[model samples]
Target: MLIHRIFQVVTVIDCVVGMMASGFIVSVGSTDWMRRRKLPACDRILICLCSSRLLLQGTILHATLFPELTQWNVVRGHSVLLVLASTACLWFAACLSVFYCLKIATFTQPCFLLMKLRISAMVPQLLLGSALISLVSSLPFLWVDYSSHLCNSTRSHLKNISFESPTGNNISYFKGFVMYVTWAVVPLLFFIASSTLLIASLWKHIKQMRQNATGFKDSKTEAHITAIKSLISFLMLYICSFIAEILLGIPSCQAMSRWKHNICSLLIAVCPSVHSILLVLLNVRLKLAVKSILLYMKCHRKQDSAEALWQERKSMSSS
Candidate 1:
């Protein structure tokens, strides 16, 4: 048990760091040339999506490491905030998937205009889906507030919960199951389906390039193709992690196995962490942007030091 808890803690830390890094990359990358004014909607969507990931990971980390500390008022408040953030992230991912499908599969003559006008349509769906999932996941906590010291859903003592209404436990469990289905299972299936189509499209595209190497050797097309492939690989990992989570969630399996929860949590953490690694590799522009930021910071520090020395000299002369 101690070993398992240690593994869970390590995995949670990895996931939190990965999510934060990915969010920063996405946030910074969005301001670069990859997203022009014409594509600002997509930028906004991606930024929100990445930001949600950070929040979700933060919640999970707190649940895993600081369950006891949650007894504090601030921890309790943060727990609720993390849950909301996770639900919002799920909704955003769903919207992103659907948006890609529309752009790739059903490109109409006025698709850009339609995208611009109907982008707002996705906001309500995201809001509604997130709210429903949050309500479901959090319903169980209503019956028991464990002083925020234990990880989320870490406690097994049902009797200590003082506010157990007759149906609350059942409702809570049901809500949790629903969130597992909606956020993890359903989206996973969608990712698999969409990714399958993307892979097929990429295969056909590559075949065409092979047959007409001279005509299709444009650098932009090659780069776009590579980006698509990277995205599909990331989606595949997401699907695998989700499937692992679903398998671990089986009632019989969880009941029979003491280590199931930690194992599943570790598997789930692998997705975002692996994704962070890939984003660093695939996004050349992001890599350069980070280098530039570091360079700028170094130069700014030197300038600050120079200014301080000049200020001292002027002050001494004035005296």
Candidate 2:
């Protein structure tokens, strides 16, 4: 029980960090949108990604803090929304990876060139389609018996989660399996493909750059290297979290001991927080924002310390 509580605290902390990081992404995109009255293609996709992830984190926070509320009728609706949000997060992430691949990868293939040329125009449609697909995938759950399947415990990590039909109904389990494929596996495949292409393109570009007479890495080479590094890290993080989520949502896994279940849940919760922070560090503008914020905070703390020192000196002199 002590371990369970500790795990819950850790999960709560993860959700809070995820929420803050996601909120930062949303604020950055929203500020740019409001200021310019227009959003760039990447920011548009990012906004959608953050929004869905924010929803995912918020729902997790609610469940983590209020595990006992899982039995409530209203929790069913929230669970369904959580599934939709989680699905949308996966889709938007796949779209973002594809977008990055198109923007940065140099491929002479006609299809690749055509996609690169048109990806900006396709961003809006892709965003809409992602949400629509997630909605359609999640609609079947509205009719399923929520209590029998979704409200499995006092633990909220998997509350209202997808890909698990109620136990003993082979047909429902089949439905759950299909939804899981559509919701997660498909996006994972898409992401893997995009990352592979992007990495290959970067490697080829670096090899060519090395052959240049300058014999020094240029800015473009550095940029490509940075992107490749980011993509690889993101890819690994995402794949691990994806596997953890699959384990968490499995019906058989639910019968496992509490500590094992909590461990899996913690693994699933890490992706949003870590990925959002990675995005901040990877984007030039967002990195600047973070640096400025940190600098200001440091200055403010120094000012407070100086003021306290002066007050102490004055009090000593007075004595």
Candidate 3:
């Protein structure tokens, strides 16, 4: 019981931090859009990614963390919606990875150059296409009978029992496989491929610079390195989250202690928020915005403290 409580507290903290980081991305991007009356392609993608993640995290919190507040019927009915939102979040993150690879990685191939030239114009369309694909892929879950079963299984071990009908069981397993492939495997492949190409491009650039005796210390090189590091870190976190999601589906894991289950849920929930923070750190504009906000808050706090101290001193003198 104590462990469960501790995990609950940890999950709440993770959710709050993750939501705040994603919210920051949305606010910053929206502000930029308002100022320019049009956002850059990257900022537009960031806004979509952040908004999806924010909604995903909120839904996860309500569905997993505060299950009592949500009736079983509501949870069952909205399970498809939750999956759709999460799918959108994952797809958008993958889209962002692809966007970065296209924008930052240099290639000598004509196709690559053409893509680089056209990527900015293509981003909005790409995002729309991704959303449409995610929706279409997720629509099957709505028709699949096993969604309610999965939802109930998450809440209790009773629903994890085998179905009497082998045909139903087979169909459920098939649907599960399809969902895993579409939601996890597809995005992972895209992320891995993009990361590999980006790394190779950066490596080649570094080697050429070294041959030219330019060294590898320029701002551009540093930016490339930072991007590579961020991508690698996000990939690692993504893999962990993917594994956690898989494990959570297993009956044995669901039968475990509540704390153990909560731990897996926490792992899955934190990925988007943590990745957004990494994005902010890697992007100069976003980082500056976060820093400015922090500095303003610090100054405001100091001013409030100073005013309180002055009032105390004045009251003492009058007394």
Task: Give me the candidate number with maximum lDDT.
Answer: 2
- The candidates, ranked best first by TM-score, are 2, 3, 1
| Clashing pairs in model 2, backbone N/Cα/C closer than 3 A | none
TM match of model 3 to true structure: 0.85
Q: After superposition, how far is residue 41 of candidate 1 from its true place, in Å?
A: 2.6
What is the lDDT for 283 in model 2? 88
Worst ten in a row by lDDT for model 3: 162-171
What range of 10 consecutive residues in model 1 has the weakest lDDT sum? Answer: 143-152
- Name the lDDT value of residue 39 in candidate 1: 37
Collision pairs in model 3: none
TM-score of the candidate numbered 2? 0.85
Q: How many residue pairs clash in each candidate?
A: 12, 0, 0
Candidate 1 lDDT score relative to the true structure = 0.60
Best by TM-score: 2
In what order do the candidates fall by lDDT, top score first? 2, 3, 1
Candidate 1 TM-score versus the reference: 0.67
Residue by residue across 1-319, what tens digits does model 1's lDDT show? 6897798768777887777676776777566535564434444566666766776676667667764542335544554565466456555665665555544432234854576457556655554565577557654544433322222244443333532234333334335445546654565565566556555656776676688888546674566566576667777766666666566544343332546666666766667667666666676766787788899999999999999999999999999
- Candidate 3 stretches with Cα past 4 Å from truth are 68-72, 146-177, 250-260, 313-319
Q: Return the TM-score for each candidate structure.
A: 0.67, 0.85, 0.85
Superposed Cα RMSD, model 2: 4.6
